[model samples]
Target chain A: MRKGDELPPLEIPITRTLIVAGAIASRDYQDVHHDPELARQKGSPDIFMNILTTNGLVGRYITDHFGPRTVLRKVAIRLGAPNYPGDTMVLTGTIEALEDTSATVRIVGTNGIGNHVTGTVTFSMRDAE
Target chain B: MGDDPDTPPPRPDFYDPDDSAARPKPHGANDSTAPGPRDPDAVAARPQSGDTGGPAVRPLAGDTDHQTPRPHAHHPPDDLLTRLKAYEGHPAAVAGVGKDPVNLPMIRHWCEALGDANPVYTGPGAVAPPTMLQAWTMGGLTGHTGRSSAYDELLALLDESGCTSVVATDCEQEYLQPLRPGDRITFDTVIESVSDRKTTKLGTGHFVTTRTDVRVGETLVGTHRFRILKYAPAQRKKPPARPQRPRPVVNRDNAGFWEGVEQHRLLLQRCTSCATLRFPWLPGCAHCGGPDWDTVEASGEGTVHSYVVMHHPPFPAFDPPYAVVLVELAEGVRMISNVVGTPYDKVRIGMPVRLVFRTYDGDLTLPVFRAAAEEAAV
Candidate 1:
């Protein structure tokens, strides 16, 4: 991977199953991600994706693009808008800089509302063939 | 303006010690002025001689009875934030070591729990999920006993300031290498930073961040940054509404478990081929990969394998300072549930428990385990 190379956008359909499954998988028991009514009570329109889910998705995106050999060094993302069910989140990233064996990738995940997540991911490419 | 015309003026005898005309004498039997036994430990001696039971019901370690004890105090100490900040860069966990090697069984359990069907996580030559980074570092059922003293001191200070409740805010992780089976991991964590005083909907407290570096042998493999808010639970103007427990997500693979629960039967999935029982319900057996399975109704007998007293980020549905346990069933599968009918701290490993179906809210019934010791005593 070289600086300025943009990763292909990954489109994921947000489903209730995905929201709840992701929340459960991450060991996060927060209700806003699983219960629509609870989410509403907490000032959201519907059940939304959790930060861990977003992080997992981002990890999947980078690993898929960089191949199995690419090792994730860091994933630092801050959540913004909520990714509610029935919406599609498209994650895209561009290589921000390149070091000897690693590259800094700036990623932004957007949905119908706006940017749901934005952050930087560092990957070590030493094991790449 | 000094005194209203309708108000009676202060009596001349108001300041007199013998002023029975101005004030009634103390009359309660406990208010007697005659000196009784001056024993300092009098109150402590009042309990029955056989009350070993008192300690059995003592509050769990992390139980912060915030709302009942200090309902009127909303803000933490003014210097608490500063003192917490002084702990920045201090060791939170040291000489931390992973008890079990990064193995397939744990990775498999994680995938099953999350309903993750990632092909790479299974079969031979499989790698553990990257997100399993923290799981590998967890202290398991008994807990991580390698926590440093400074971390305990900081928590004690936070507790003293009435910022006794805490909830994990978020975590950021970076993986440098893929973890495979047999890879032993070790980690060391340091206090990263402490945020200034802030008021969240939960309450007013500081956000503490700890950074952990995970290594395999000598190679640094990952870095995990976890943040938690230690705050006083917010006081409601009116009695707070009891929140409903979030319903479990039942999918095709695990629907049988919930169905069994509805029938008041605690079912453990037993692989028909290997006869190995498993829990949290799985479609296939981890031991033999047998897709066909049957259910075994548990005898409702088990022992607490491990437990934690949840006392942070108080949730509406859950009472803080409650003990959540990992129980090893008599049939040999482990499941996570709340330990009831005993003090959170008193729920110890190896304590016997019996399953009971409880209606959490008016609507939902869950299989909860109560301490068998308490049952026998009653």
Candidate 2:
């Protein structure tokens, strides 16, 4: 991948199952990520997506776009709007810089309310030759 | 799935809304507090939640029946805090032992759930993930939490004081040694601190922190510090129209498979070049770069390969205590879906299941499986 190359945007439909599945899978037992009633009691309108799930999804996006051959070296992200159930998160990546076999991608995942996650993913691909 | 052209049908699609409806029933699972249809046999058969493998973990704190406002509002903050403070630095659990020794099955399950592929977790001389420090001590749902009566009394006091809603605020762990299979685990916990009444965006409550020291045969393996916020649930928003179930994204490659579902057919892709059978409609064969493929119908016969029951964080759209299962078809392929006909706990590994189409929210339709073998009741 070269600087300025754009990876196709992946649209993820944020579902309740996916949210809960993602949180549990990460071993994060935070209820705000899964329980709606508790979430409301805590001031949230509903359960929201945890950061690890967003990180996992971003990694999946990069691997899917760069082909499975790429190795994800690092993921640095800052969460913004919370991804609530029934919303959709559209992830778009742009290669901000490239050096040797490694590429740095700028990723933004936005949901109905606003940008849920923004970060940089750096990955390295092996040369087929 | 009935066409029978010699190739097996497709596995249920994960993205399909209809597939998400299989609700797991709570029997011995500690992850959920929701009551659902259950069987006595299941309770006897299944290990308490927190067993090493599938569907084991769920949020722990704030799992109680406190939605209704307590007639007596707010216990005096000073009194509650004073009583809560009395437990500080007290031993909550001592000589607590793990249900199972550190083993590969649990490690494998943890890796698979998180999609972690680090080489250190598997193969020869593999060590369990260091992050699994706390899991080793959660003794199963058989009321073996290894807690001292004081700790139990402390939580009971908090519950009685009306802090119903819970959210885990933070966790800190320090790994001193790597845990491996065959190693026995032991731990001790102390009530580290309980904070005074505090207000945050989520609500107003006190913060409870517990520190645990985990050991493998006297070798200090790790230390886990956990904190949670127990707040009186705020009733700011009226429960809205139960949120509709989540929908799937249908693209060109998987469109035919969904269309087949619409027609009550489960279709599998038969690669034209290599003639390999593939579940979950994909564009090309991984076996060969074959560009084209056709469809085949499944026999609607499969066995449960594995499963996890969801009991916590009940969603508005989906009910708690449902089973999300992985089944291996007779054709040697696997897919994920919810099991409908039996209680979530009743579903077991190697049990037979047959495919059936289900619709949710009055409009969404997808394929689900019902236990094919006759239940003891049936």
Candidate 3:
């Protein structure tokens, strides 16, 4: 695999429930993350996912695709635009390099409005029975 | 300029509105004489105001039209987001050290077993050994037995597949002071870098390097650079043989000096009576044999009083071509310590030296001397 090769799309729909759930799980109490009114008061368009939540979700998507036998060696990701509720974020991973038993994958997540997060993930895989 | 009294000063045309203050004075004006409200034509030429307060509002004919454009809040860019995300995963694993806690009692036991008798460790000043402070704070050894630290938990999550083993190898520490008991130190550990290495068994495994910074409150106590190798099981190999070095025996009189060496401080015994400075610090003065002696802190800056290059040391830990020097400090004191940071051939008597802390076995802190440039005369 090399750079610019697009992988299969992993769709995760953004919702108020998921945003709140993630905020709770990560213990992020910043009101702009889960309260739309507070977010607007803070001059944002709407409530959005916290950076940590976005990171955890992106990792979850990659690990899910790679399966349990795959070991996630490393992941580097950056959060971009705010992911608003009701937006469907499409998570995509492209194989950047495959050497020996290890592969480097570039994962990107984008809503229809704009890109939300992009990262590079490395994994070592074993043959499945 | 005189006009008839009945002329009423030509009845300034207030109704004609050329001077009427109520007829929409130039929008930003506090008085009619000021420039009329900013030109409507110019306002129309600019971008339209959005509901989210995109454009600054111009005051209209009434006060109700006042509006202020709110600025957008700055959010982290995609690149920072990506780096932070990548940091969430565990670092590659190395060998030699595991994630088990180095408990406080265990550390105390290690210090006692090693025979360190500093009051800072045993008596009223019984502070935790400075280097051992990191293990007590962040090594998952404090408080609970089975619980892992924040970094350790992340490492466990990364290695859930169990394909690799994590090991810690290198550590660099700078001691500002000793850590007394009951001081809770916090740690921020990050996966510095990761790479792949050749596999001896089957396929390639991962090599992870982590930089764990340990701090007490806001003061940085030490930094540990841990290198781990994660790979499958390999064939059994023979253990490497150990090298030996001359071990200097320590008596009660010289014990404090060696302890100072282990603490990375240069300590010397100064006689209060004859003012004689002695090395290998003894409890009694060498000149007067007076028992009135006190510890003096050495600046660790000195001149090489004498030297030797050992090429025939048969110990596994003692490598050949290393210089051991007797340095005469500025205070008229002398000490025997290894000279580092200079070529073996460059070493000479009277060469200026500075002290440095060296870590052996990832635990013992040893103070050694290295060459330093002489200061220019003022």
Candidate 4:
């Protein structure tokens, strides 16, 4: 149980389309993000999302919950494990501190297998009517 | 608490387009109106030409569809070849070139100071690391060691000319042979071109591209291209605040000092035998290898010995324009600290400063130094 927590568990379906899109969007041309054989050569279990992709996905998940009105003030993240295609990532956030107009949320992203990325996000919100 | 907690509100009209406060125009609505062409809001709302539209597109300002012209797409092969050949015989120039080969001992000492033990550098089997070459080249170890290399001398020249902002924007290098210890390499650099660009916060400056060629005897080893942006003074944006890190607890070997620092005191270890003060919080003094020492509180006042305004944040807890300073304190103990409370342009060698403690997350305290006087004599 955490303070200022309202959103439910967000399950982001990981797909090859999303992985490829994320890689191309970040200008990361690493084949491991798209080609399975290249990823295998690099000692990965399979084609996996890159750091930038993981960051984008996690940012997107939080923003979707808060809606377009919220602005992301800061995000600090550390990559723990890899997120491969076909693994659904569940992004969970716990409000660590709450102010009159803002809140600091500790967001942890994990797949069914294990945790992938852990980070703290500080965001500002409009007053509740 | 007389008001009802829960109440049903009146239903709003569905087709009320005249409600003045219902909706505001989209963001960037007043960006521009004298348009030869315009993108409709509906089209703009849709993600264009990339994936993960939220964070990615927001940072990039240029045309998304502007295709990067191929290396030689527009120019004829002969013309490209001619330009390449013209550059072949021309001497190579590097930006921020130094006078000596980075004082090898100094580099090793700096790495050790950071408490990093990456074997590729310190191990017996370690070859010249790729990064070491870049560092060495900047410290001016390319060729002649008698005077500051052409690039170092150029910076001095530029500084004397009153150029306020000097920034290294792009660095591209091709490594042919791995550099090894004891390899004396000679390098010559030439200014290829300098062009004016739009003014940034640092100031209105020009982009200078220098080509550097490294040679071992008559054999060509490698080439480096360096681009630096120099600007004049202007209003600078305040860097974003860094996230907090948990403080590490101090014990017997370091206890009296951690407690003092928590109380905003600058404490140093003084040797009992030689009366020498050691920095970086080591176990013993480097001068006499004396284990017996006494705790001394520093006044936290010093003069800047040398400094660098890092545009690139090296750690997660720092931002750009952060000055990494080497201060010669009154006690003669030069310690490394981040200089705050002054414009980046105002920092200079021999500038007086006083220590200030910045508490982070209510636990960790960082001893940052700030200018001591009202106005820094530029």
Candidate 5:
């Protein structure tokens, strides 16, 4: 794929089950990720998405676009908005640079509040044709 | 970040790959993420170094370095690497305490998410899941709860050297005692070692390892080692052939089931004398001692009964942090399989699923279920 190509967007519904599952799956047992009560105690309005889960979803967004053979070499993201339950995160990507087989993608995951995650992912894919 | 990103380059655990142009491979997808003996051995395999392609991975590629000439950009590569290596055997944490004690609510939530029904995690005389040794001590969003200055310094050096990006590669844990409720957890971490620069298909970087000792007061409970691969992408090498899946055992009793899978049909055994249906193709019926049975094709409708998500120790040709579920079929039997057509986190208990025989790496075919929900997302 050439630089400047846009990946198809992915919309993920954020549910309580999704939040808890993502937290447990990534072994991030922090109370803010699974316990709404503890989350309030920790100053969050509700349970929210963990960084690891965001990383996983970003990886999924690319894999969905480039086919399964896509290899994620680096995922360096920073989170802004909290992904609380009932808010959906829409992920969209733009290929910023392509050199040989390596492609650098700028990814953003936006929710109701604002950008949930914004970062760059450098990945490669075997000739997907 | 503990997910293995460099294992045999996995298929989308939730999205099936188009295999029309796919070639059969050599590593078992099932074997890649399974917590088998391979994970511990892999914790020692370091990332390698490579300098090729263009200037994509050059230090300070990120525009965030707005400051004037940095000292790291002028130093020799060996001197910087030597400084990074010097931190080995230094304390990464000093008397670090878990933010929370081992409790039942967290345990219950963990089991519910994993769909693990083992009675040991709950009820009276309960103990936490052995896999959660490192979970209790996690720093959460307020990171570095117990981080020492030395560990931070090493990471800063790596960051300044143009290896600012990082992803967790893998982890190994060994439990010496059960972690029970009400037990306060404490741990000590040390910089294990910094690898010589290494290269994988992903890029060139060093594998940083840290060893942790978990304890309840003075008694040692377990040991854990986590690997973080600090990397920047380099040359674009032709991707290796897709790795093959571990072959399923096909013995005399189960051979017919595998044969049925090969033909893209799920087969179940029906007892001739007792009319009892059985899964897994046993030699005889449970009710009657009749060795005679007939094959019945399953209609492939099912619901998720129980499930687990794998997120560590990635293998060749498989992705971690993906769901593996036990599905209860409409025919009144349950079988273990993988899910496609939905993100793994969206898989829930009682979710409807339909059976599909999928071929991976263009060769190995297995009876897997696809999420039946019609959603607008990929």
Candidate 6:
């Protein structure tokens, strides 16, 4: 990976199953991710994805590109907008900085509403080479 | 790779009036469309309204169906939040011990459930997923044996004050070491801080935060900070519709497991070369580095190795405080599943259990365990 290189974008079609399965998989029991009516009552349009799912997808995005040898050092991400079911999220990233053994990649995941996730991931790529 | 062949098409919009056949209308609501077969269970779960004519009776403070009122009606007293400050730094859960050691089986189940195919979670030098740090500290069905008295007191105080409902807002975990199988884990948690009175769409409440330090025989492995809102559930304009359980994501690597459930059979994989059995089917053997594997039908006999009662973070499909068990199959492989036929608190380690297939949705089936012992018959 080199600075300014654009990582291929991953498009995930959001579904109720994806939201709930992702929540339970991450051990998150929050109702907003699984219950549409409950989520609506809580002010959201529908069941939306949780931060953990976003984080996992980000991890998968980077690792899928760098191969299995890459070890993620730090994944610092912030939530932007809610990712609701029936919406698709497209994740794209750029290598912001490159060193001899590691690189810093900035990522942004956007959905129908707006940016769902934005963050920086620092990973060790010595073995990835 | 972008389009997973196994993914089922998305369901139609729930609120679409034309799609009345897709979802059942809420009870007592106007039905301009054809009536479909209604689930009695769903009707039973709906909160009963005392005065249907006056207004929809809001669920009790802790009800999972609790709704935040469209307009703010109440704001908690600031002094009440100040009193909560006294409990800050108080021990929440203490001497919390993990009933089982950090092992591969649980890790595999987690990975399979998450649709995570990361190679680092498996193979010869595999390590537990960093995100699974909290799972290691879970007390299982019996629950945390040594909960702090102060923590219980705080909850009682909140209940008395009518802030009885609770929901986990979020959690942050920091892994300091790579945990390997066979590592014994232990942890202690303290109420890190309590937020001032605040109002959200859910209701008025304070955010209670706790910090837990997980260690393996004195070596710090991770730090987890969990936060929740203890609030009085607000009333909704109308009764909310029942929520549905999310379908599991089955991919190529783990499609066999779900298929086994459809046939009401529990299957485990054994490496064709080394004969090492695994709860989750994998392409290659972790021990022998073999590329081939075969199936072994499980007897379904097992014991509750560990478990947890998810009390907070209430969801529509799940009732709060239900017991989810980790079963050690007679086949000698442990798997994460739920224990039925017993109260959540009655579940314990070493309790004999038997496997049973449960159907959640129209086409979803999963293997769950039920307690074998009844009336304390040892």
How well is each residue in B1-378 modelled by candidate 4, as lDDT tens digits? 111212211111111112223222122111111111122332233333133221112212233234333333333422222222122112234232333443445335433322224443445544443323344444321343422232343344345444544544444444455455556667766655544233443355445666666665566556666656554544334443345564666767787677888888988999998988887577788999998898789988789999988874235555456778999888888888777878777889998998889886776787888898843553
lDDT of 4 by residue, A11-128 (tens): 8778877777655544445677788756644444467766555655555555567764454554545544456878888888777666676666666777765666666555675354
lDDT of 5 by residue, B1-378 (tens): 112323322221111112223222211111111111112222222121112221111221132244343333434554455456545666678789987899898778766654445565679988776556777888866775677766776787787776655545444555667799999989999777777666543355677888899999899988877767675544444355455678888899999999999999899999999888899889999889899999899999999999998875556578666899999999998999998876889889999999988888778898988877652233
lDDT of 1 at B310: 89
Using alpha carbons, what is the TM-score of model 4? 0.29
Worst 10 residues of 2 chain B by lDDT: B8-17
Error of 2 at B231 (Å): 0.9
Order of candidate numbers by TM-score, starting with the best: 6, 1, 2, 5, 4, 3
Please list the residue runs of candidate 2 whose C-alpha ends up more than 4 Å from where it truly belongs after superposition: A1-129, B1-75, B237-378
Comparing 4 with 6 on TM-score, the higher-scoring candidate is 6
- Taking all chains together, the TM-score of candidate 5 against the true structure is 0.37
Q: RMSD, each candidate, Å?
A: 23.3, 21.0, 32.1, 25.3, 25.9, 22.0
TM-score of chain B of each: 0.45, 0.45, 0.34, 0.35, 0.44, 0.44
Better of 1 and 4 by lDDT: 1
lDDT of 4 at A96: 68
DockQ of each: 0.10, 0.05, 0.01, 0.02, 0.04, 0.09
List the candidate 5 regions with Cα displacement exceeding 4 Å: A1-20, A24-129, B1-75, B234-378
lDDT, residue B87, model 3: 28
Per-prediction TM-score, please? 0.48, 0.43, 0.29, 0.29, 0.37, 0.49
Best by TM-score: 6
* Tens-digit lDDT track of model 3 for B25-113: 11221221112123344333323223223122222223223332122112222211221222222222221132333234544553443
Give candidate 1 misplaced runs (Cα > 4 Å): A13-16, A27-51, A81-88, A111-116, A126-129, B1-77, B108-123, B139-143, B148-172, B199-204, B229-378
* Candidate 3 runs further than 4 Å off: A1-5, A126-129, B1-186, B189-378
What are the lDDT scores of the predictions, listed in order?
0.70, 0.68, 0.53, 0.54, 0.68, 0.68
The DockQ-based CAPRI class assigned to model 2 is: incorrect
